[model samples]
Target: MDIYINKIHYPINNLGAGTRLGIWFQGCPIRCSGCVNRDTWEAGEEYRLDYEEFIRALLSFENLDSADGVTITGGEPFAQPRALLELAGFLRKRIKGDILVYSGYAYDELKKKYPDILKSIDVLISEPFIESAGDRLLWRGSDNQKIRLLSKKASAVYGRGIDRAEWKGRRMQFSIVGDSLYMIGIPGRGDMEKLYEVMKKRGIDFEHA
Candidate 1:
């Protein structure tokens, strides 16, 4: 199996509970308006990697064991159901961490189309990014998105206070991977503009990814 990925990062604290391994898929059919990861919206040959190679690379990371979970975000992870399934299966077998997947497709729709996925992942953050819906939820881009706890572990970890009332604020983590700077996590409306303005004054120009 081969996977197309934008990048992979470890010890990601903003995307999920505790530290996590974050995998950014390289293609998205649901190119949501105001998506911060516009650079990940397209798939290309340059992003291709053999699935085994990817696993080997992950195993090589010395801090991989420190991660509390795995966050599979995209360009819409459900867009590649087969690879997603394989990746999830691998994680379930070897990683022991909770598997969380994000999708632009609604939960009900995904349950109908890719029912098998429910067995592989622990949590699902579903629904498209609605630019006008506003960012009022934790770990979500918009209020319309739904977080479904698909496994017992997820329920135990996230079931208690997973609602708007529990939303404190959106948090972001910055990491420099190779030559690109990744801004990980959901950012509220106007946040990017404010960040850009702040960076501009400091003479550091940034292009959105």
Candidate 2:
């Protein structure tokens, strides 16, 4: 199996609780307005990676086992259900942490369409990003999206109450990979603009993804 990938980064703290490995899928069918990851909206052939190759790449990370969880975001993870199933299954077997996925599709839609895929995922943040809805919580892009604890592990880790478990403020992490600056996390309204200005003052030419 081949999966289209945008990039994979380890030890990402902004996407979920504790240190995590963040996998961003390369394609999104639902291109939500005001999305920060515009660069990942296309399903380009260059992003394809064989399943074995992908595993080898991940296993190469020396601290992979130390990660607290795995966050699967997009380009919309549900856009490629088969690949996601394979990826999530592999991660489930390889990591001790829970699996979290973000999607533009609603919970009911995903539950109906991809029950098998959801089996491998521990937590899900679902719903399309609504630009005008405004930001309201952590681990979400907008107010319309919801966090669902899908597995027993997730329920324990996140507690029975989702809102209480996610009371912290939203945050962003910056990483430099091969001369490209990758911004990881959910940014609030106007957050990117503020970051751009700050980076400019430091003489770094920053561009939004």
lDDT of 1 at 183: 88
Best candidate (score: TM-score)? 1
lDDT of candidate 1 over 1-209, digit per residue (tens): 78888988887887777889999998999888888889888889999999889889878877666678899998888888899998888888877678999999988889999988878999888999999996778888889988888899998877756745335766788988678788888888899999999999999997776
Provide the TM-score for each candidate, comma-separated: 0.94, 0.93
Q: Write the per-residue lDDT of candidate 2 for residues 1-209, one digit (tens) a residue.
A: 88889998988988766899898999998988899989999989999999789889989987779999999998988988988998888999999999999999988898899999988899998999999985867787787778888899998888877743443677778898998878888888898888789889999885566
C-alpha RMSD between model 2 and the true structure: 1.7
lDDT of 2 at 208: 60
The C-alpha lDDT values of all candidates are 0.85, 0.86
Clashes of each: 0, 0
